[model samples]
Target: MTSAYPNGDSARDSQDVSQPKQSLFPDAIAIPPEVLARHRALVLDPATAARTKRGNRPISTVYRADSMLIPLREVQSLVPRPGQVSRSEINNELAKIGLQLRPRPEQEVIDGAPPELGVSVPLVRLEDAPADRAPDPWTALVALRDAFGDRVKHFGLDHLVLSASVAVEGAPVSHGGMVGGTPVSHGGSVGGGTVALHTGSRNPVALLMPQPPRPAKVPAGRRPVVAVLDTGIGPHPWWSKHRPGDPIIEVSQEFQDLLAAQEGQQQNPTELGPLNHPEDVPNEIQPLLGLIDSHAGHGTFVAGLVHQMCPAAKILSLRVLHTDGFSTEGSLLLALHWLAKRVESGDPDEMVDIVSLSLGFYPETTDPEKVLQVKAAIERLTSLGVLVVAAAGNDATTRPFMPAAFGHGTGSAASGVELLSGVGARNAPGHTTAAFSNWGEWISRWAPGDALVSTVPVWDGAALGGIRYPDGGGLGPWMRSAPDPDDLRSGFAVWAGTSFATPVVSGLLAQALAEDTTAKTDMVGRAKRALIATDAELARRYWQ
Candidate 1:
């Protein structure tokens, strides 16, 4: 899609006056093409069950399993109540296509949704099913929809969701060997003797400056919170330097409980474990190899952006994506549903004023029903007064990316809060779209995303690149040379993508809430007012 604004002074002047200037920073050292290629091949390989689709250009790569997620209520709607008739009928219908219901989790596990909202059953294809049947969950769902037709629609079967794929929205590697209409370059270099890595054609240079967190404007108990749903935040000095009882980042007790309960469930890989320590290395895909996964430190980087924007806001660091940059729609649904309920409880301590989603997917189809469960979960959060800021995606295509696209138009009254913000990536001055950023009407706002420096996990990956004076650290403190492209030991990186931009918008909204001393005291009232007012202020300045 063509950019929304043409280049030149007119474009710069068109930017909202209320928005701050987006400054450019030195880019991070680029990962070697072979390293990026290896990572992408592992994550997006069709043999791995991950799928990629082509549009005007290649979009995002979505990783999926063979299972389908069927909302229990929707399935129940297909059959009479158990008391009225035996419950065997539903199972019988599932058996027609060789699908079988997976075991259910404890009600407390999926708490926040209605008690009757039984665990979403993962219906697996029978190993012995006919060979001619649809091979994947989406195809099977389509077949079922076709067969059931109006019956499915009448029963609100929209929730028969795909256990679809969702990836971190950052530009990590090219999908289908293409990004922004060009093939990824196999080589690149930067000054300082460091080998600069290029993601697709976007250069990410190495930088050493970590954005320091400013003091909170609000007191500990009253600070607004922004929940970052992405690869978990790893160890970083920004949070470690804070005094006890006051932290810039934290995982809530409730979120901890959810993770603990979900652990070992096998239904979904939670990536659940301790965080904020050196031992808690962020590279999950190939730790032994010591190579940084394409998405390692993604959450930490995003959290740091928010920290710089609103230090007074407590960051709820939720780890939903694996270090490899992939997660399932089901896992996201669980987190979102749980969050909606957490907000519904009206506990000020647990209140999340903004949800920064730097991840999303392009659904196989645009039919609203295809995204029903995910959209419902998001709508539930917004209705409760939390503003969701999602990335418009990094593929530079106009294809609608989920959750973010929900922000398009005025939004539904059911959303309860102001509309969700679909954020696109703008270049340094933050005026025009980044070449790698997805655009089109669904994008509601744009922020500086190209080569912005922020905190990353202080990791020395296994990959061997860049030269050093001493072969094995024999020089100890003296040995130094070029930046290792994959090494994040500096705790800072110059990365680009809509992933980072979403947090800029989230942090700004949180800043507005934190600075609003005269706003209503109630959580919902304050957040709603802040969201509407901040959104309008943004619209006045950013939307062209």
Candidate 2:
């Protein structure tokens, strides 16, 4: 609901309220004021201070977000009916709470910054937790999302940034009734020698597993390389495809910033790596233009989907989103420039095969300005021979989203050089269109969404353990119904958004590329054509 650039950022709106409010950071573990006062005292306490001696500090606290909500009625109560606490008085009180609430642990996490200086980025969904902390971590996260409900934003957590915590086991309602897993063919998806993977089942991955890819004739595991420049990825089982030994990867900004720096330093030109780690490659994978104002985990989720689509592919997960979900124009410009520089270098070390983005360039710009950036970036990525895939956005009422709407619209032949693909979401047998799905005529391909489950950090899962009262988005109770109804693994979820849809298409797009060895640069164009040319249904529905 809050999407304006910041003279009054969403952060300001929360601050506009009266005092005694709880945190909006989803993982908030309430600490009584007395407890906080005690903790602060201990930090500066001579005795407590001496215990650490010279060491910086230890992570003694863990966030326990019992609930991610604050009743709207509670907030209404704080609104001092009309004449009370004029702006100046309100300002004084807010200034007071502001100072204290900030340094608070949950507050930092609200910005996607951990309370502790080095708490590796908090993973959002269960499928996206670190290897050691997968399923359980995600459980905690959902519990948190549920706990907060509409109170989530009011508590100061990133709006639209949520963790999905479904379980990934067999769906009793959907496992094709194949007992002991006789290997359902995944609804006609063959996974050998790059066959297309068609997943229309109600499985945890939102994807029915494709038949495993055949071992290369010579068993040559020529893994594909993929770069996901988004918020961040925490180690998760679904992410295990890229693992040489173990694959659930989420790159740290610490190390990535280091990788982003040209090897030689400020004075020297950027150097292509013998990319030591696969995670290090996303920044260098494609020409990243800039960061968009999306939540941190949004990028992380996109990264996870790309990895899911191409398990054999090496992934470079780039963290571009900020806590408030704002990435400056400069950041995106630099991101793109780096990719261009790497691609033009032509060094094998700098070579990248593909890039998929679930984000768009800055909105609010003139059509020409938007198109110029899109055209140029597509041109550059094409020149470098990198296949670029982007989301069409979730604006269901309009034409397909910007870059995808424009880029895919003109087609490869018209663009002449670069090939771009725009994807839309589809509702499968058990699925319904995402209430918020952005679709229409200009739409290209429809993959899937509408309660399609994916990944999120564990802690949030535990917090939002059950379905929150639907805030009016037509949220279904499938998450809580059983026969295990949808049989979603985490036992609770029914997300509605294009964010989910984009990833579904993203994965399939990668599958298309992975299938062809003599892959052409225009593969993206060809794929676009494949969907558009055959979209009689689309034509009848909206293009009439």
Best by lDDT: 1
Model 2: CA > 4 A from native: 1-221, 240-255, 258-296, 323-325, 347-349, 365-371, 410-418, 430-435, 439-442, 460-494, 519-544
How badly does each model clash, as a count of residue pairs? 15, 58
Per-residue lDDT of 436 in model 1: 60
On residues 107-176, what C-alpha lDDT tens digit does candidate 2 reach at each position?
Answer: 1222221111111112222232344522222233223334444332223111111111111121112222
**In model 2, where is the ten-residue run with the lowest total lDDT?**
163-172
Residues 59-122 of candidate 1 have per-residue lDDT tens digits of: 2233233444556455444344447653344445656767654443442235446423323344
Give all TM-scores, in the order shown. 0.73, 0.44
RMSD of 1: 8.5
Which stretches of candidate 1 lie above 4 Å from their native place?
Answer: 1-63, 74-89, 105-109, 115-120, 125-135, 150-213, 216-221, 252-280, 367-370, 410-417, 470-480, 519-525, 528-544
- Please report how far candidate 1 places residue 187 from its true position, in Å: 9.3
